[model samples]
Target: MDNGRAAMNLAVLLALIVSLLFAQQPKQVVVTGAVPDAAGGSLTITGENFGFVPFVTLNLVPLTIDAVGGNRIVAVAPIKSMPAGTYVLTVSYGPSPQETGSFQLVLGDANDSRSQSSSDVPAPSISGASTDAAARVADRVITVADVDREWQRRDPAGYLGLIRQLYDNRRRIVDVMVADELLAREAASRGLTTEALLKEEIPKRTITMPESAVVSLYQSLGDLTRGATLEQMKPALRAWLERISEPEVAKMNYVEELMKVSARAEVFLAPPRVQVDRTPQDATLGSDSAPVVLVAFGDLVSASYARFAQAFSKLTETFDGRVRLVFKNLPLVGPGSIAAAEAAQCANARGRFWQYHNAVVLPPGAVDAVRLKQAAADAGLDRAAFDACVERRQYQSVIKDAIDEAARYGIKSVPSFLVNGRLAPDPPPFLPPFDFLKRVVEEELSRQTRKP
Candidate 1:
């Protein structure tokens, strides 16, 4: 009887312990509101279960956190002059960095009288009233169409940029999936595993780099080698080179052969295109009526821009009369960037824009007043007139206007390209490869031909 009583007591204790453990577990975090300061320099986020302190990012860029409480967080934006648009605010916390929630943060000009306070702004409705309505705010019904219409009306370019980004992401994923399926089917047809088939085909397509070529690559490393001799780094260097080049190249070549030559895979997915207007102020190359107009936004001092410039030069040559290259200044980097852009404009007035542009960008150096003057000489410009134009800052307004236009198009980074009014879907800090640009130009040409 004592044992039976003791067992019942133990069971009761266990139940109590389990209930306590469940109760102690933290509630799932939820971001209820985000409010930008009047100056738009700081953002305050209100949420539940932020877990002491949480890491926050606005549009994937980490914010400099200012203050954190259990239910509130304040952080400074990365960009001081953030363009007015809808931004994604993401929060993550805990030891393993579990994402708490994502909140949509709509913003307007800070000085705009229409800007509302945190209390005035409507919270996103969590529950739907009916199938037709997206949300119910008290007695008022908000439909998806209504939300979209309002968003489009407020910022058409931002809305379109978001849509294009979404389409590009989806298209990229679909391409990968289709390629995977094609490979799987091909493997099955050969009565071989995909892995086995890749192993058989990849080696045939791989190129073995010669010893001399490897040495040349090592010499090109310069300071990147960190005082290490070529002989000391030879094996590792070869391995690194092979790792970056061989397998990927072999795989891509094989996939191209399968898709283009063997299976003749056709992707009918149409890419999203925006109407990018050209102006007389734009410095351009090639015929005005060319089917492919490639508008390039770049900073003169940017290394990425330089790389893209080289590719652009090659592309113009390859396509000849078919492609028109338009250059627009987006001077985002360094103190000298704006000056360089202005100087380029001065060069443009003297019919030396391309020559001066190539001299400044094609070389690896910081652009300054001295270099600008020297480039003017190299480009066969009237140095006295060029200097005068730059001194007066004749094109400052033009550069400012260009910057504003870039912001309107949601372009925040340099080396951005728009091919025939369609923004090239390449992520920042990297330019599209020459082959990719060629393919885009070819596709644009084909598209134009199909048009009645």
Candidate 2:
């Protein structure tokens, strides 16, 4: 009995091992290659495992075969079943199975047709223009082509509108160049152009960009399109929008430079209108006699204000006790912005000013009322009290005081920084020419040390 039982167990184990070994074998099939639909009228998939009579199926679309050839098989991808994208091609014959790799259904262009030759569609060429005009036209063409090429490579089917824009921009540049040359020629023939005036006027470009004009342009371009998608006109839209804002950008750049021209520019030295009697300061801040007080007038909504906070934090760390950083809130974004200010003040009242400030002034989109209240609650402020304070606009007076002070000092924007009683030059990121505050503080420190 024992011998018979052992024999049965060995036979069962052998059958199990054989089943596992067969399962480990790869699927009995091979796929040579798949040609895209455009390469030929039909996709040719070549491979073998056909049992002298191979049966094939493509996504449940069955195929019948009359004969099978050695190491190769041909199957036509169904035109109606497959759209323009990649799809799998499968073939099966009972136990013997094969699956072809991805077959691409490409948009058929003239170039892909077998009857067409490479020489038929010649590459775009630039000719028949004056040297400078030709060069400008060429640059414009290249810019349009490059942008289209990139967008199409990723999203071919969706870029028809972009291609149209490229053509339109090319036409506009061509017209502009032709007209410019004609004007130059006429001016020369009539002797109406002076050397100095021409030189000065050529470089001095005045582009007026009214805010309303940009809003109108953006609207006309379907920025507020009625349907599901905004049209893709990025290349032209970017250049035109930048062009429209040239005057305002230039004016701001000029103002920033003027403020940095001399050590005495004094951006923050607005004429004082009121005198408040000084009350003796508290003992909480160690010694309240710091020589330099850097006041940052900031708004939560404005982009520049966040940048100001970062640079101010760095400067405060660098100067330590010599500089005491004071932040005054403007909170002009909306109700949301005001609520944020109130929340911060509530945290400050609980001796968690720095923690709350850091949390709120974090990268934009990272702050909301929930997170603000959470930070306050974590900082040991009563959640209910903080909630009530924010909802009731308890710190409106605080924001108002900051605004009143700013108005008195002729300040109109957030990120307006005062370093030792002078307004710091608020240059845009691209043209941050100089740091006047740092210079003044360094100069004053040097002067005092020299006197001793």
Candidate 3:
């Protein structure tokens, strides 16, 4: 009997100790409420055991309470500065917390509220009910043609005024067309119709777009349109936005007009046109029988040179021997730098001209005597032959002849290409490069075939 009583007492003590341990642990509670403003606005919090001891965290901000006497506590929300724009209020206590749907904090103005309400309100539309003012206005103009219908509307001034605005808008459009016609007539009378307005204006008005601006604009379009492809949209959008925001709109308008004039005007290029003598007279064509001889006038040192080379190479391949590429080396390294031109000529002699050409033109290497020799060796040219050519300055005359050729073609820059014997003004946009070159080559070839 004594042994039994002792065991029973021991067991009772162990149970009491376990119960105490459980009781001493921290008890968690739910914190519920709308975020409160210090300015007399109350956010109702619905949760249990929001006690005064420990602080409750709203978002990442901590809110302290004196006590939670009841399950429902109206904690006057602290003067918390919230982020601008819309956000969901996430209320929490302890480790795990809950979110209280979405809430919005707008510009603290009555007008903003009114605008929000107006946006929410349904307005009649030509297609269906609309909440957009711009859409509604556009629809009303399109559908409501009858003057009686316009007058019978509840808001007479609003509706009739809108109608009148539409009429006036159309009248202005007609006026603009008439003005354009008159301008064209005047240009014809003055012999200005033959010249392109865009061509004339771009050089005068084109703001050299900052590199950062171009990149930023590219990124912005990428973000907005999702899949609209930057190359397709960038030039047009950049011109449009810049025209509206920058003070350079007039210049842009002039350039646009020049383009329009160019589009409408007929171009009569003479046969067997004197191509730019930028390259050497002995500058061999890629193929003897290739009818389309593309004479590329560029310096290997110019960035535009590498760009054009890549484009021209693709064009050569696309045309499949029909296009013979002849590069004219116009060595404009700077005011008096013939070293690069001399090096390019030497490379040409070694049959590794293209290889050395690309190396010097691209970034990441210096174009000097030693570097040029190394580049030639790297391009698989015979070292001794390459060095001799450089030392002797063998192709100086050839280089000069190339420059003369370019001058004859009226070429002034590196990478200017002559299609057949005629000059093409710009490089094809590189996105679908092969297709573009192929199309041009095919068109030119077809035109030639039809001639005879």
Candidate 4:
């Protein structure tokens, strides 16, 4: 009987201990409220059974506790220092812990909440509510045709914009249609084809772009090129910089040398005073105080642009601080080419336009969205930001206006130059392309000096 009584007492004591332990166990914490999408704001948390001093963690990093007493605790979110993304917000109570739920740590200023902007409007055309459900049942693999079809079906405006190249070729034909019989006859008399002369003379007059020079130019461009190297981009770099140092190294205007003996080819044409100097916020190179300014309207993807850019690079070096060149977007090739122009503008936003200038050849087959992002990655740009900007088409109107203005100027070709308000004719026997440009700038300088 005594042994039975002892067993009962022991059982009762065990039950009491289990009850005490159960009473001490902490309650599940619920994150009831968090304010402001990103960091740097008060986060309100509540859990009735929490210990006097509970701990809080954000994105696995322990945050400084402000106060933790009662059923509710307030903790300050990390000071917007954490990168922008969705992070798990965990609140722990007492010793026994359980974690759940997340808060999206947004990017950008919290105070500048932009609900009133025009972008706030509902565009159900892109809402794609159907895609949310369709994605699961849709083909796991997407194809070119699928993307194209979906793109056209989803964004009809985008489809129309892509089809409409702002620059029309017929306008250029009319501008150049004045018939250069005199220039043609002069060329024939000299037994020179402007094309053939350049083909032969470019080699004789142009210096090879050295590996060091190429590397120097590439490195000097800074973050725009990112981690690109001379060897990897050698062919493209060589092509762009090939003639940059030629005029300096050769120390002779091969065009002037030829022009001295031949009758001057005078095609009296003036570029319409269309606005080329857009703003200081453009991609530019050379001295702001220079006497001559070159407004270059060139296509990034054009083979002709590569040549023109090289020639212009030479002028910048040869002109003795008397010239400034501004690059205005004239994307005439197509949407892909226009997209490439937009990519350059995106880089410009980051002060990496020169690097992007050199890496104009880095994009994939064409400057599509995927290719532009890849190129941005290759260029070491903030791909997320760049991709977002491209999607927004922030610079579309700016580019379109430049194209429209080019059409107004009757610019139909890839690389058209305006030197101090004169439409620079394509190379004739007397003036090679670069030399003609140099001559125009010098004449402008002379005129500027003579102004009384």
Candidate 5:
């Protein structure tokens, strides 16, 4: 009886170990590649760990799932009306991480039946004063494309700024529309009017401003109060604060929570991007082989650039070896700006660009002959050689070229940036926050890793 009991105990121990090992297996979701259907309007994705039914999206737009299996998924591509371009495809399963891949989809005639690799789509004819032309200067037609090219060449910065503004406005409108629709649907489901639903929800989420907060805000206002005492301003201040913070803030937070928990929404509308060139003569930081190369066009004496310089240094430290910074001089402030840029370049020639940059370019003050010499001396440069180099205006042509390049690239403002040939989005006021820059670098690194 004792031997039988011992054998049963050993058998139970073995079974428990096997169950634990199976439970510890890692979950994986990988989208390897996709093949467009020969008949068009659909695609097959081959991958692993696709659950019974997986959600698929192309550029954040959902697709109808036709079929699904553990390693293959068939989905209808809604690219019949979309413009011809490459799009990102993603797949997600319950509790498994989403995987992304890219594929090219081309638009063609409805009757034309060809394989996915066939390129039989005919180009649009542009003979004899095209209707799409921006202007017809007495038979010399200027197409819309021609106008766009000219605009980008002459005022690249302004062109990009306009594009960004348009995108922002469109995005904001879309967000409001989506939120409204979501609220309407949710209210209807709960048998309540939209206004009534908001009335009920917003109040619960709103928090009243504390007395201490009001006092602190009053103290910070200082001269903005127009010599009014705290007691006199208290009611106005509290009312203003409550008006800005209560219903609106609460409603926004409630919508955000609903977006995360109930519905999954993703925005894939990308900003306009421009290709920026790099040269061998550029003053640079970090390794040449770094995954991200950030090119900054700036005026040396500009206060905005000086403010950004601090954030730039922090970015380098945070990203470490993953990012490289290439500085180009725009020198738009004045002659003193030009002189300072030249002096920095002179220091670059002596292998002291960063040291001179810290002393001269990163400081907020007037740039003059004395200040230039003082900065060179502070950077431990040979004063005589540096002075001669600056007197000759050695890098004036280099600075001129940089300014011309900036104009060509539409970089009219100080502290413009490009990461790996893609233009960074314009920031509010002076410069982008450090966290925003960090996200850009991390995204570039991830993209590089995803490349074939």
Candidate 6:
């Protein structure tokens, strides 16, 4: 009887080992490439292991697949599913349930505003002038493509801002270009050339710079005069001061003017927004230039987050890409909570924070050491390193600092938030959390719009 029992136990153990081995076999799937287009356009996804069917999402928003092939997916992303910004595009196939990666969608020429030049720029009226005069004076619609072409024709420095992300150089350049175009269109509408209108308007607004200030600026620049008379530097100094003071010109309502005139002109407009922290250490999603930022403080084990995880996502979607979110850790529960926080940070280090967050933290389930490891695996984290990170408590101080910061703010709740540095007030109990958050966001947006 003892021998029979031993054999049965050995057989059971062998079966378990085989099952584990089969489960560990890698999923045969790979997203080889993507032919991305404008935000609302179709994105062709080329990949393997899609099987006969697949599912897709852009930041958890379901996508409508127009056509599906063995290794291709032609899908129509919703109208605003991806505004001009970045997103995590996820695809699910038989071998891979939810394979995810990042992709940036930029608005294309279909939204081009470029059409015609100002008719007031010495153009011939239909009532008079020769054929050559009529052709020379014709309206010129400006496409962003045309703007780009003109940019290329102009100095490389003027165009560098468009392609380069180094500085907000693009904003500076685009502002000038858009304003110039808008001004031209406005001038034409008033039956005057842009140059003529600017000549009249600028002189009235130009400030008289103090002589002492101009001299100081010249000396600070190590005398670009290069042994030329101080008189020579005076003009340059005055010019510099004048240009700096012209920000008022750039701040005009160019977009409104363009819309009023129905002129085709593409301009990169800046969002009116504020931010307290712009660090990647605090998890951030969406464009850096987004107008509103929602900062939240919570422990990974907070049950409160579970109630509003979907709500938070909905709030983000409802706002389009205008609002960016930042998540900071504040461990308040226990050792399990602390460990989970550290594990989350580790996953964040591996760029899997969102996945781990959904699977482990916000999911409606109790967490333990075993559960934490399983969550890490489900989040597609590197298990051995994740285990090491959790054991070592690598992000312990990070979580502690965040918790201390939350305390300083007089926040004792697990799901506290600071919307653009203003503590979110207790929202009305009648509305859902998502609606409350949306109201908070809309209020902030309205406030920004009201600002000069």
Query: What are the models' TM-scores?
Result: 0.61, 0.36, 0.40, 0.39, 0.52, 0.39
lDDT tens per residue, model 3, 190-288? 667624543454457656444345344444332344354544334333333344323244443553464466334222232334423332333454576
Q: Select the stronger candidate by TM-score from 2 and 5.
A: 5
lDDT of each: 0.75, 0.50, 0.53, 0.59, 0.71, 0.63
Residue lDDT tens for model 5, 1-452: 99999999999999999999987664566777887764677878997866676766554345778988668999997555665454556565542222222332334443444424455667554333424777778879888778777887777778777776777777778889878877887789889999999989898999875665556556545455556566545544454445554556689788877777656654455546666777655888887788899888877677667656667788988888889999988888888888888888899989998888888756667656777788998999999999999889888898888888887666777777888866676552111346557877887776666523
Candidate 3 minimal-lDDT segment of 10 residues? 96-105
Candidate 2 segments exceeding 4 Å error: 1-287, 364-366, 378-380, 431-452
Question: How many clashing pairs per prediction, in order?
Answer: 0, 1, 19, 0, 2, 10
**Which wins on lDDT, candidate 2 or candidate 5?**
5
Model 4 score (lDDT): 0.59
- Worst ten in a row by lDDT for model 5: 95-104
Candidate 2, residues 292-325, lDDT tens digits: the string is 6656666655554664455555565566677666
**Native-to-model Cα distance after best TM-score fit, residue 60 in candidate 2, in Å:** 55
N/CA/C clash count, model 2: 1
The local lDDT score (0 to 100) that residue 127 gets in candidate 4 is 28
Where does model 4 exceed 4 Å of error? Answer: 1-277, 362-371, 429-436, 447-452
Q: Cα lDDT for residue 134, model 5?
A: 77
The residue pairs in collision within model 2 are 268-423
Question: What would the per-residue lDDT of candidate 4 be over residues 1-452, giving only the tens digit for each residue?
Answer: 99999999999999999999998655565555554323446566665544565555554344556777676667776544554444445554332323222233444544455534566576554323332433423558445456657876776445433433322233344433422343344457769875564555557776654455555444434344435443433333333343234543442345444434444432232233333546644677789888788888887776557545666678888986889998877887787888888778888888877676666653323344565565676677887888788788888877877776666555667677777755565543223456657877886776666523
Off by over 4 Å in 3: 1-272, 275-285, 335-337, 362-371, 428-440, 450-452
**Model 4 worst lDDT run, 10 consecutive residues:** 94-103
RMSD of 3: 24.2
- Residue 277 of model 6 has an lDDT of 46
Better of 1 and 2 by TM-score: 1
